[model samples]
Target: MLNDRYDNPLTTRSQSARDAYVEGVDSILSANGDGIGLLQGAVQADDSFALAHAALARALQISARGAEAVAAITKARALAAGISGRERGHINMLGHLIDGDGALAYAAALDHLAAFPRDALIAQPLTGVFGLIGFSGLSGREAEQLAFLAQLAPHYGEDWWFGTQFAFAQIEVGQADRALQTIECALERNPCSAHGAHVRAHIHYERGETEAGLAYLGEWRRDYQRRGVLYCHISWHVALWMLERGDAAAAWRIIDDCVRPGKVWGPPLNVLTDTASFLHRAELMGGAPQPERWREVSEFARQLFPKPGIAFADVHAALAHAMSGETDALAKLIAEPVGPAGEVVAALAQVFAAFARQDWTESIALLAPVMATHERIGGSRAQRDLLEFSLVAALLKAGRPDDARLTLISRRPKKVGARAVAGL
Candidate 1:
């Protein structure tokens, strides 16, 4: 068995393969696209490298190559028969994740970490995909995520990546001061950490610090590679902040330059959904997005529909189709089975559809029940704000000024003026 940079066991006998595998893990921790190639190199260097294959499966899974991820993990499982306990745990963790059993994967990761605390591969599942820190099905995931990270501090003392992940969980749980300090420490260790930068963005967004958020991303993104996993999503943050600043044109410019359909990097599903959401939100604000843009997103959504178990993606797809005037496509997407997590997304879709028809009362009714449950769909507090915006807008349009005023007063930041209510 070979060991990773943190001295975690890897089921690879070849030294070159081990090095490539470690590099791949590091790339993933940094959110670099190079991780995919590095992990592929590891497997190429040694076909029997079970741990490398497992890690590669995770990378492929995040990249939306679901079939390839299944193949890679299947190969990993076959080779795992002879690996050490730690390596087997890694394989098990990734295998469960590939199988879409997030709870099982998370359980395996917890067990793996208890035995081998330095295994960052095991830790990845608790952040990126069905992460406890981000979009997780577990109730009170934030508190559990923070407690878990705190418990692991002794195992990963002063590690930059751990700090970044911990800081993100901190931000989610309303520990902003600690999150800021932790992320700053992480950035001090490696300024190029895209994950740290992302956490910082979340910190700003959650606090409603729009200008600080913009300046931070503008400076940090100057050095961030567009090919990385987070560039488009981070750019989406910038666009959102620009909208918050009342610079609708600036928001559209960022979308056109970095996040628009056919122009952005990262997963097609993620980029197109974010682009479509931005366009729809802009239109709601009375800022005109080019109709062709909506059509482009509609085309992308059509390609991804009928595979709608992920609620976040489904909600965005519905937005794309509805905005583009593809009523038939929208209805078909709504009718697809999205599971319980998708329930709120489906309701939000109905809200949008009703709002489009100027049926404000129906829109308000559809939106009211889903507002609290929207978080169950696993987007950031920032991403889920789109749903809140819809609710407020529908309330106003329904002539429920008292209700809209109460919503804005309770939910929106005190800094924002009447423009948010004035349709941009």
Candidate 2:
């Protein structure tokens, strides 16, 4: 007999249903399995309840049931048709979860707001989706998204989610100083926002404050664990930091504990495979014990390279060959033509191979054009950093000290770490 109090029905039963929906939302946030079951029951009883569907979709996404999450979001959108105010805003938020392309999701949210002018729920998804888009390496798209969100920031003052996203975008465009300022503002407004903390940790990492970055990540991990959710992206960043510091064993342990078991929403398997490949290369550089996991990851990469949507797999495979001293394998990978981004990665992989072989001249030759066109190279800052470091190292090893010094001077102001110094 329960019905939503806000619905057409005007009775105690409707009031009870409204209370149930509220309880369901709270339960899902608290990671209660029974709460999700109750939400399903409530949605079955009232197919027009948009909140219940959106909440259910969020839970499903957290559980890694992407297809089910999409279905739930579809239902929520249908139920929210012609609705305005918070209900429509919630629908837009759920739309972000279902849309794979970040730009498309932002557009859809903007369309929803064109109808509902004073919607508060729009801020949460807009910020989160924009942050993820920035990570996907489209700086232009990220700037546009941030500008759109900034227009609403005045009306939505102290929005921690939006502030964190703005910080993340700043980091993407090599503006670490601005990113640090924005993240500090976010933490001042909401110290409990994990995304804000994660951004702050990266800023610290970029500044070569490795210990501070590790501490920040520790706090973020503990906070998410207490909330019964895991932020896999932060964990991945921690792993990378550890690898950079020549602690491959510690990096491997972090990935094994948090990422490999699928306990969290980590990167796709292929991406993790690439991380493992890099860790193996780090181990070789640091004289650490060879990890058996590297071979397993290599096999995974080999299987993944032939599949579409796994363009980065080629780079990982090439790195694996370079690390293992398999010149023939490396040559084959580098010789194969690829897209613009892929071509850059392939050229950079050749630099790694040449460096490993101590062929400094060939390494410099391979990397010069890539470095000259670095601005036009389409990939994340992380990928570009790898290529830039290789080029600087090759220039130094080839005895072009002046060119190496100039490259270091030009880039070191923007980036940090020994890789930028290239032994100068």
Candidate 3:
């Protein structure tokens, strides 16, 4: 029996196969290196490596290679019969996710971890805000995510991958000071870590350190390959900071090059949501989001997400549809929303629609109450700023400057530097 880097027993007897599996897992976890490529190499070196096949499927699914991922997972299930219990459970959980069974996947992850805590691959899906637990649409999700990572912390001290995730969990729960230090530790251990750089970017954004966030992330990402899992998202942070600093030109350039639809390599969820969010935020700042840009994003959303299940992406899709005058698409989401957070997503859709209609009063009324529970929409607080800024813009537009100022003061005290809203 060979052991992985995490000291978990592997059924693969080949050292080379084991080595590739270890590197592949590290790559996907950090969003650096060639995770899928290396996982394929692992399967090639040992065709009977059930864990490697399962892991390959996970990486493929993350990259949004749906058909290939299905094929890989099918192979993994076929090979699962003779493997260890840990291997069987690992495949099962990932199978659940690939089958679009988030609830089952989440439950299976917990069950798997109770026995094999060091199964970092099995645990990866449970770590981040975009993970199963974060998008579970449950209330107190931020606190829930932090507590889940906290429980797994002792098992993974000083591990760079786990450190970045733990640090982000803390950041989302309003623990900026503590998160800064943890992310620093992770970055120190793995300077090329894409996830490490991303978590640090979120910390800077949370604390209203726009200049520092831009300077640090801008330089760090210069060397990151564009195809890396987090490249478009990290670039979104840079564009956000540029907009904050009143450099709308630079921000739009970043959007055109990296964050826009068909412009960069990224998950469709990220491509659509980031494009819609950035364009709307730019619009709030009084920058013109061209008609063509809105149409492209709306069409992209329609093609990729004709129906909605993921609330985070759904709300953004609704924004694109509303802005592009895709009334039929918008009406469908409003009429029949489905998911735990479907209603929240529907309300957000209505908010965007009203904003598009320039009916500020209606938008404000619809948006205000949802702010209390917008965490159900999923995504980090920084990512959710689209809603916060949307509310501010609505207040400002509705001839309510005082209310807008009060909203900023009560909700985002530290982030009150930039003036993106009209008449504020």
- lDDT of each structure? 0.78, 0.58, 0.90
List the candidates' TM-scores in order.
Answer: 0.90, 0.68, 0.98
Tens digit of lDDT per residue, candidate 1, span 285-324?
7675566887888787777655776767778877777767
Q: Arrange candidates by lDDT, highest first: which order?
A: 3, 1, 2
The most accurate candidate by lDDT is 3
**Best-first order by TM-score:** 3, 1, 2
Q: Candidate 3: misplaced stretches above 4 Å? A: none
Per-prediction backbone clash count = 0, 1, 0
Candidate 2: clashing pairs of residues: 3-14
Give the alpha carbon lDDT tens digit for every residue of 323-373 in model 3. Answer: 999999999899999888999999999998998999999999999999998
Model 3 sits at a Cα RMSD from the real structure of 1.0
Clashing pairs in 1: none
Worst 10 residues of 1 by lDDT: 415-424
TM-score of decoy 3: 0.98
Judging by TM-score, tell me the better candidate of 1 and 2: 1
